[model samples]
Target: MPPTPIRASLLLAALLLTSPAWSADPVHKEKVELTAEAPTHSVKGKIKGYGTAEYTLTGKAGQTLRVQLKTNQPSNYFNLRQAGKDEALFIGSSGGNSYQAKLPADGEYTVQVYLMRNAARRNAAASYSLDIGLRN
Candidate 1:
């Protein structure tokens, strides 16, 4: 069957986005040396403007992942993302300071520390401490 115009456009856009020519950044840019069973439980960084501290953690499907963020400023928060994925797996920004989720895939995942939306929009810099725990 012939593809619809919108479907063809969407496919073309997806291909262009994933093409090696695009040169996209990895979701976990910091690349922490993390193991599934022995996860790194602590990290700290400062985020300014659109900058985020992305930490990579390796884990198996069904493992429980716990993340917590703390900062003197109320605008700092954290989020979780699977490697290569564009959307967040778990978001802690709108709620409090922590998030825990049962992982859905086996791979290197990201723990992103970022400022709140308004803070980020203002290009403010905030210091933060994050703790990540993974358990099968």
Candidate 2:
């Protein structure tokens, strides 16, 4: 059955309000670069088949970063892991839709967005905005 007009309107409104960080399909989660010209990065996508959508932020040692995610679905959380490492550094998860940290080295850092305690059901559509930037 088709969604009602009011319901469709609300859905459209939500999608329109979401920032354009949602990446196209086949997102490369490890190739994010933040520059002086473009100091923030945002990606929007979904989690299918229990896998996470990955993103990377590059910065120098001692740089403070605040990364946040805004989502339209439930059970969406992100993990922050150091680059080239398998385990999440400091065992940290976003706890909700936000992550913050001070980088320990000058290199790449990984931010992984996932669903429901590390598992995503099939065809579950999740839209999210990732905001990564330096702390003021």
Candidate 3:
């Protein structure tokens, strides 16, 4: 039996909604650089709609890593994850903006800035400053 036009449209919408990765948001990536004289690096950016910004840095296992975010949008948050890992070490929305912890491994780490789904869907814009610090 041929499906009705309404059914086809509804099915397409459902697929699109369910497959967020298939229609994933764009990500802007940057490397964090800190010289020997400075242990901290600060970066500023703006994210609109569903876009995200990713910052990558390297650290040792025993070093303490600190990340602080200041943003005008309440829904804007950051997540910290080790490269090649699926789980997040920190989720800023639930854990708050300031994070300090000892590194779990010696490798590359990523800090991702984004808005919550609700705010993202509304095409909201957020301006933020992120500070990354590393210490022994």
* Candidate models: Cα lDDT each: 0.76, 0.71, 0.93
Task: By lDDT, rank the candidates, best first.
Answer: 3, 1, 2
Q: Per-residue alpha-carbon lDDT of model 3 for 54-96, expressed as tens digits? A: 9999999989999999999999999999988889999998999
TM-score of 1: 0.68
Highest-TM-score candidate: 3
Summarize candidate 2's per-residue lDDT along 1-136 as a digit string, tens digits. 9999999999999998886744433344567877778778777776664557788767788888888788887677778777777777643343566667678778878787777753454546577788878642
TM agreement with the true structure for every prediction:
0.68, 0.66, 0.80
Which lDDT tens digits does candidate 1 get at residues 1-136? 9999999999999987785833432232566655666575676677776667888878889988888888976887777889888988877766578888888888888877777778877878888888878776
* Better lDDT candidate (1, 2): 1
Please identify model 2 stretches exceeding 4 Å from their true place.
1-30, 90-94, 117-119
Better of 1 and 2 by TM-score: 1
Model 2 TM-score relative to the real fold: 0.66
